[model samples]
Target: MITSPIWLPATLMAGATQAWRTAVQRRVGKTLSINAAGLVRYLYGIPFALILLGGYQLLFPAPFPVLGRLFLPFCLAGGLAQIIATNLLIMAFGHRNFVVGTAYSKTEAVQGAILSFLLMGERLSTLTCAGIGCGVAGVMLLSTGGKRMGPMDFLRALGQPAAITGIASGFFFALTAIGIRRATQEVGGGDPIHAALIVLSVTVLLQTLLQGGYLALREPGEMRKVFTSWRVSGQVGFLSAMGSACWFTGFATAPVALVRIVGQIEVAFTMAFGHFYLGERMARSEAMGLMLVACGVVLALLGAL
Candidate 1:
């Protein structure tokens, strides 16, 4: 079956964000005012989301449901959870390491798979279960390092305020996936893609508002960042909205089994970008982990088996 052109765009978007920030750093080298690029990245994400919502509405018109308002609770909870998880991730990422965040986040696939089965009656094959196991093994292998950390050391990392927070946030993200799927069922009937878009729109909008509130308390006067830095911010918003839209659109068009299988290419995309853009050298263990993630994704997407 055809998988959507899902992972490639997402990889590009991820790379673009990194490249944009790196460019900003070079231009402002040693001037040291604000992390102009980073701020712009978050700020412009708002409008990107709005434009995405509008486009979705135009492309797929379904009435705002009057009868299915009950699902709003699920949507809201999921949204709140995503917001919390994301902010926690940002906190850790801001200080500790992006690789840590990325590696740890692989856990979400298992969480998502389990939740999908529980909440949506989407059955998991034995092979898929094995795929999930391999994914976990790969993540663990990727995360481990005798030089930097061992299993206990890794557990200690999780104990970090940010890491624990990430766990909590991941729970929310997982719940959001399931809850959104449920909400999608209510709003989208059986249309998976339609349901995914509706859920994403609702969740992203709510989360964006929450992000605004955080800015109010944290920065208080950061609105200028979005305005003055629209070039950088706009680029950010454009790429983010585009990637998300593609994921949702692809989800709507294909079987989720295939969609998620192709989605695993994101791991490869991350590795490739890191190699070329960030000058990141891959460790032997890292390569093994990446291979595992790739294998697991392929197995998860197995059409014949």
Candidate 2:
């Protein structure tokens, strides 16, 4: 069995790298269509993912794990779910400012917790559930931009285009995590990292083919822009590969809910990137919301212990 401690560092790495990659992907979205922007990561990331898998094999040689019958279905489902989640997230970005857009999607932790429980029979401690609640409340608070609104107004706010797309994105992302974790388990191996990398490699390759083919048929012209914007697109791809590797590792080693709870740190990173890197101004409420998210993460960690 994989040691539990490995998930923490892997999740931290995943959060930081994912924040950076999403910021870069948002930049690419400015020049390309939503699907085209979504395609950039997978298209450029496949090579780096392969290299990581190859390098790991060379450093610590092992026979490739035999795939189970369910592996392809899980990988394909995970890959497709991620594609839709990514596009919806990009669409959310269009509906609101970057930071708020991301905050809206931070709901995935709670959603993943629920889905994991219902689908995988994973249970959470009371403290972890509270942490997930805190995180969700913080995200909702951020969505309001610190305005004082009644229940009705808040309900309306949740119905806004950004909220709808963001929540949908979270749901699909939860599905992706579940699918990925299940896929890795199907490998029947003791080396969690090896299984994670193999899943990562296959998932990314499938994503590239699925998204690339859609773009090729529907938006052929954008394909040129995707390649020509190589400088930025390449950075996105590399970070995406690295981030995904870490995320897959976390999934392989820990409960999906726990990994996702810790991964909420991405919201903190996203806010920092928004303020400093993108020149987006943060309101007082946004800062408060971030603190709540941090508290939630702390609670979840303590509960894990």
Candidate 3:
């Protein structure tokens, strides 16, 4: 089995790559319909995922595992959930500021822990729980960009369209994480990385077919837009494939909750992207929040030790 130290790098890579993917997807969303933008990642990414699996097979040949019946269903569930989550996130982007919109979805770490325990029977330690709490609090603080949010303000924010969609996005994302983990387990092989890549390939294939079919049938014009905007969409697709490869590898190596908690660093990366790339300023509250998130990360690592 892979150790925590080995999985940590994969988790971090997943988070960092995903942050950039989200930014690219958000930009694509402005031009295409929400669903179409979400579809871009799956459609364009299918080729890259295939290439990854092919390259891996060539470099280190191994017999592929025969998947059980449950594998397809789990992969399908994860793919659909991710598609829904992505679309909902894009919808939230329409309703809130970018950083705040992304922050709302960071609720996934907590929800993922609960779902992992219930659905997969993975248990987390008390220290891990504390880390999740700290990380989530830090994310919330950053969400406000240093604005002092009182109880009433917080309540009101929750009632907004963006917050509602954001929370829903998190829920589906939790499902996606669990479903993918389950799928990878079902694929069952000695090589964790190889199993992960195979699962990723299958999931990407399923998503591409599902999303592409829907777009072709209902929104043919949007399909044209997706192809026409390949330059940008290509970046979203490649990044999505790379990030998900790292994520699946992490899941194959570690407990789902631990991976998700560590994955919260994506919020910090996103915050930095907002400040540096988008010319947004981080307020004092956001800085505090980032610190809290850093503390959570340290504690999480300690707990693993």
Top lDDT: which candidate number? 2
Per-residue lDDT tens digits of candidate 2, residues 1-305?
Answer: 23568899999999999999999999999999998999999999999999999999999998878899999999999999999999999999999999888888889999999999999998888898889988888888888766777899989999999999999999999999999999998897689999999999999999999999999999999998999999999999999999999999999999999999999999889988988889888888888989999989999888888
- Write out the backbone clash pairs for model 2: none
lDDT of 1 by residue, 62-111 (tens): 66543277567776776676555555545444443444444555466676
lDDT of model 1, residue 114: 67
- Ten residues in a row with the worst lDDT in model 1? 25-34
Candidate 1, pairs of clashing residues: 85-169, 193-252
Cα miss at 283, model 2 (Å)? Answer: 0.7
How big is the positional error of residue 253 in model 1, measured in Å on the Cα after superposition? 7.4
Candidate 2 segments exceeding 4 Å error: 1-3
lDDT value for model 1: 0.54
Q: Estimated TM-score per prediction?
A: 0.72, 0.98, 0.96
Query: Candidate 3 clashing pairs?
Result: none
Model 2, 276: alpha-carbon shift in Å?
0.7
Give per-residue lDDT, candidate 2, residue 157: 92
Query: Clash number for every model?
Result: 2, 0, 0
**What tens digits encode model 3's per-residue C-alpha lDDT throughout 52-117?**
999999999878777878999999999999989988999988887677788888889899989988
